[model samples]
Target: MIYIVLSIFCSVTVAMLLKLAKRYQISIIQAVTINYLTVIVLSLLFFKPDFKVINSSAPWPIYIVLSVLLPTIFLFLAASVKHLGIVKTDIAQRLSLFIPILAAYFIFKEDFNQLKFIGLGIAFLAIILTFLRKTEAQSKSNKWLYPIMVFIGFGVIDILFKQIALHKELPYTTSLFVVFCLSFLVSIIIVATMVIRKKTKIQLVNVGCGLILGVFNFGNILFYLKAHKALASNPSTVFASMNLGVIVVGTLIGIIVFKEKLSKLNYLGIALAVCAVILITLSQLNAV
Candidate 1:
């Protein structure tokens, strides 16, 4: 329970940091690059992953894909927050759970009970309602592309992480280290290219923000993994709790701290999202 709470706090903190970054006019790319560097350092110091275990037969392909996708999605997340506000962006991110659930039904042919099906239905409706805006100008200006990409990107990343978890040859921590290293390397190349093109200048402020972001970012992942380990047999509980916790907490923070405005329909969508999570959780309990 403590692990779950810590994970939720870390997750929300990362979103909050990104929101603050936008306000401070920090460069997202530079911050993300430095964040990856911090992640690599922390991963090495804590996990101490053995590099020699990595062989030709290792899951390099998945690692490579994740390495590329992680930072890319993170950038999209920042953009989503900047354009769509934290409330909608957070909701869209939490809704990504639907992607893996749908994949299980189709690809893995997992059994879906009535509760799960109904929950999925409500989740779909919730997404539409959550993103719906009243004014035409607001709708036109706040492009849906960023949040849409975040939803899909995070979902795909989740699926890939699950695949990595299934592989027993290498430790999850080691795999994480490899992914971070690759991601950092890729970031270095991107930053170099930007420098050459004179697109942006690197500043210490961005690096400082990235360092703080990195701590919470890694904390979110680490504590979530710990919660999973603590509740090994109840993965669904962790999954539902984490997603719902983020939505509930993030919504409150956005409204209270940032003074983000939402229509009544959006609030109703949030209610439906809660129901969807509850139903999904119940379905998991029933399966167990």
Candidate 2:
């Protein structure tokens, strides 16, 4: 339980840093790349995850998916930050339980209770209500398409992650390293293009933030990997609990500290979001 709580804390902290990175003039893609780079370096130094497994004859598609996931994540997350604001984007991203839940149902054929499905329904509605704004111009409605696209993109990522988990041939750490390398290379290409086009400058502070993001991001992965291995009862429950906590804590901080505007509907939506996790866990109590 402590591990679960701490994982949520780390995720929320990362979200806050991503939100604050704007003041440092760092964009979201740069922040994500920096964050992943940080984790890769840490993985290199402290973790020493089994990297040699890549040479094994596991399967090529897994590596392909791993590579694709990196760039998709970087781009999807950046789009989310741009279109939805940090808080809503985080909610939408974390609230992507639908993808995994459904995937789990079809792929692993995991048993699902009625209440968990009901809770998923409510969580979906909750996300919609929270991002409402008074005027069209003041709201993220202008760039809403990006967030929706980001949602679909990340949903695929989470689903693929589950597939990766179920793969007997692929270990998690090797998968992580592979995905990070691919993402890093993609980021370099992006940065190089920007440099050639003179679109954005990669500043010293951006690199520093990337370093910070890397630490937290790596820690995020490392801790979750443990939790995944430790809690054998219900992985979905853990995923739901950790991510929902992120939404609650992150949304509170966004409102209290950053003065994020929310309508009555939005607050109600937030409440519903919280209830979704509770209900899902309750539905899974039999398994746990």
Candidate 3:
């Protein structure tokens, strides 16, 4: 339970850091690039993944896809937080579980129950309602594209991660390290290009910010994995708590600290999103 709480805190803190990035004049690309590098160093020290298992038979295609998508979507996450605020951004991200759930039904042909369908319906509605702005000016200037992309990008990334997990030949940690290495390489290329073009300059503040982001980002993953391990018998508990926890924490921080405003419909949407998660959890438990 403590692990779950820590994971939730770290997840939301990532958003908080991104939200503060613009005010601090931190380069998203530079910070993100260093973030991946930080993760690489941490993975090496902690996981110590065996490289021998990573042979030609490994899932390079999925690894390559995730390598590109991870950093790209990370940039979009910053944009979404900047425009849409933490409340809507976090809800959209958490609700992205629906994407893989849909894939399970349509692509993987997994059994789908009525409760799951109902949850999906409400989740979609919640997404619509949560994104609604109060005024005309706010609506017009709202960067809806960024949050929308975050939703879809994260969903696709989830699918890809699941695919990599299915490849049993490679241990999950090793596969993770490989993917991180590739992602770091990709981030470096982008950062290098921007530097060469004189579009951005490397700065110590960005590096410092990136290192902190990396710790929390990696902490989120580490603790979530630990929670799952600790509660191995109750996978749904982890799923429900993780999704719901982030939404609840992110909402509080967004509203109280950041002073992000929401309409009545937005509140309604948030309520529905919570309901959707509970319904989805119940459906999964029933399935099991």
Estimate the TM-score for candidate 1.
Answer: 0.97
TM-score (C-alpha, index-matched) for candidate 2? 0.87
* Best prediction by lDDT: 3
> Candidate 2 — number of clashing residue pairs?
3
Least accurate 10 contiguous residues by lDDT in model 2: 76-85
**What lDDT tens digits, residue by residue, belong to model 1 across residues 1-288?**
899999999999998999999678898889999999998899988888988989887788998999889889999999888777788899889988899989999999999999999999999899989988889887886478899999999899989988988988889999998899899888888888998999989899999999999998999989998999999998888988898999999999999999988999999998898889889989989987
The per-model lDDT (C-alpha) reads 0.90, 0.72, 0.94
Where is model 1 more than 4 Å wrong at Cα? Answer: none
Which regions of candidate 3 are displaced past 4 Å? Answer: none
Candidates by lDDT, descending order: 3, 1, 2
- Candidate 1 vs candidate 2, TM-score winner: 1
lDDT of 3 by residue, 1-288 (tens): 999999999999999999999899999999999898999999899889998998889988899999999999999999999877999999989999989999999999999899999999999999999998888887887499888888999999999989988988878878888998999999999999999999999999999999999999889988998899999999999999999999999999999999999999999999999999999999999999
lDDT of candidate 2 over 218-280, digit per residue (tens): 777777767876886667767777877788787878788777777788788778878887777
Model 1 lDDT-worst window of ten: 136-145
Which candidate would rank higher by lDDT, 2 or 3? Answer: 3
